[model samples]
Target: MKFNESLFDNEQTRKEFLQTTSALLISLSALSLLHCSEEAPQKPSKNLNWITTKPEKRPVMNVAYSPTRILLKNGIIIDGSGKPPFTGDVMINGSTIEIITPKQINFKGTTIDCTDKIIAPGFIDAHSHLDWILPLDGHPELKNPFMEQGITTTVTGNCGYGVAGFMPKSKYLAFIKNIGKGFFSGDSSTQKDKFVQKLAVSLTSMQQYLSYCRQHGIPMNMANLAGHGTTRMSLRGYESKPLDKDEMKTMLYHLEQAMDEGAYGVSFGLQYEPGIFATNDEIAEIAKLVKKKDKIVTCHMKAYSALSGTYPLKPFGTPHNIIAINEMIDIAKQTDIRLQLSHLIFVGTKTWKTCPQALSIIDKAIDSGLDVQFDTYAYHCGTSVINVFFPSSFLAQTPQIYEDKVALLKLRAQLELIVALLGFGYNDIQIINANNPELAKFNGK
Candidate 1:
């Protein structure tokens, strides 16, 4: 059986097709950085031409301005208002939806006959890392996966980390090269220094990262949240402890600075360090800062299984998944800060039964006036560093745990439990991205 090739003729249909299928073709991180920085290496001739045909006063992100209009006519519209699908015309004035009507629109500078097409509000990738691709100096592309799927905007700084505008010189360059090209191995060793020195300019602060795009141009509108992992790592470097009084003060100061610089909110990677090191009390204190600023806090919880936990210990207690959910809810209740739950995955086959209970918890919280919401993946699996699979407490041992006889026995028990919880064996896992070039051969194997 074959799909009709002509489905590509419709712009909207084609966008959806490209968005869903691109991953089958290449790694997901193949996002294109289309900024027109004259310094893009290897090819000095390409550029990104931006249009400000309709600009607004104090435009979001301070992007360039101009007055413009577009009318999408005769389309099936899902207005996102809980109404049934209807045939209508949608008008846009710059980035705003100027009007929507059942009849033909009037005074359109650009009109598209979206006949037999699905016209809806632009989808937002609420958990995204598009900002990470923005600073990449080379290996640019014409479009990103989100944009191809008709996504107009994306939120980045997810899973408790993001590329900040104010990254230190070494961290900034290290991040760029690591994400762009996998780190240089034996054969590629000579290329590392060359890559970093050639592109020495690192984004300096939240303000600078945004301004860089405003000046260079970005295809989709983006909002970044300050990463709790990054902020804590900057001061503490994964020591497995909460911030002290003065350290907490410094953390608050940095958060305020980021908020003033245009961060949409803050996010936590509770499963990942140094997020795992943070206590509920510590997290609540940080949330209060967000509350004062009227911003949000998005958290990737400590565990995803109903009974599975890092340990039968503090920070991550038994029934870890439920404990993680309650932690965020508790923060919302205490600080009154808007809370966003990331992914909300239930790992391990046995844990899925707890879904109703999990949702019930969130439902009770929202019904009681606590501002809470969540997002999840369309599919079951995800990509991450292989080490993310283990408990942080176990991983934080002085000498890494792989070789010791007793440690290995203990680790085997942990692995056996993890395997039992998933029900699916190891075959389900696939390697997509690897930092070590030697391991690159195993990708997609």
Candidate 2:
């Protein structure tokens, strides 16, 4: 889930998720709007990157406007300054704010009585997967759940996985959208769906995809990141190998081209395929490219647990979560690029106490002049792709394990240990959307 408008507009939701979101310095949250207010307080050193920046002066575009524009009246204006809220009236001329004043302005146009309601800037979902709609030839549902939540802008192509790398199949879209057992319809016995029938979906390049989407119109404003996983997959499909000289050159060319085509930056899904296999050196090279472009880097770390991750599969002196933190920090330090850690969570039960240590590492890095920050989910519980909790080798050898009774028992034993380590049993993990029909009966059980 992305940070929607509810993070700012909806009081209960905000308080439910975060008692104080003061640490979201680098995020696209309305917290950035604090610096935009003339009455806003000075930016603190901890949030150094939140310094106010005045855009280059440019004339407003001369577009024809409707005579009667909507106006909001008698609303409590929350300027997002972390200051006290004030009562005010806001006048609008189309999407442009004509005025925001405490004193009443007598207007004859359509007026919306926002009495006792909050009038804040439109929210930005910095970690959105709206890029999931990339495969649709046309007709994007304008009234989707995001819009219902008052989110006007979204940062798409997050988690470094999307249609960016491959032509999305109906099953893939279904899986991402949580569309029931249809996503796992790999067998002939499954019901045939029109959605499953392949359609002509081209435009693999960043510019082409973006241009196509614009031509079709969108529900909200979006800034997309080129998926590092997708980029690797495009070049080498699921090949868990290091990049050679030629391949490195090609990858650079592809990434640079995406930036040039207006991708916001690069995102790394270190826990996911192609990205999981990515060597530190390879990641460094990509980060360096982002540094050259002066764009941001977002990463989903390799592991969030005490004893699991890509680094040596397990660490000796340090925990896997700490190693993951250092990995991103070191990348930022080396490349001097702005880095954002996506959904920083202590995965297993044993690692729950590692919170302070993780924050300490990040705090020290930021104190030392590194541009680093992170975001987290509201609750302690989470869900993940099955591969996350199991060894990749175990997943790869699934058929073999099933065939050997001893191996199957061993696998079950390992799962039990992992479950206990996670501080929850299999029962705690609710099946929101099971992929396979054979598993549909287990949903919500």
C-alpha lDDT values of all predictions = 0.63, 0.62
What lDDT tens digits, residue by residue, belong to model 1 across residues 104-211?
555526778876577888888898766655443442352466677888888888877755523355343444434333222222433443223333244545776677
Question: For model 2, how does the per-residue alpha-carbon lDDT over 29-98 read when each residue is reduced to its tens digit?
Answer: 2211111234756664433223222112212222233475766776777667786556666778866887
Off by over 4 Å in 2: 1-67, 81-83, 134-143, 165-201, 309-317, 392-414
Clashing pairs in 1: 53-66, 53-67, 54-66, 54-67, 54-68, 55-66, 165-204, 165-205, 166-204, 166-205
lDDT of 1: 0.63
| Top lDDT model | 1
Name the TM-score of candidate 1.
0.74
Q: Could you report the Cα RMSD, in angstroms, for every candidate shown?
A: 14.4, 13.1
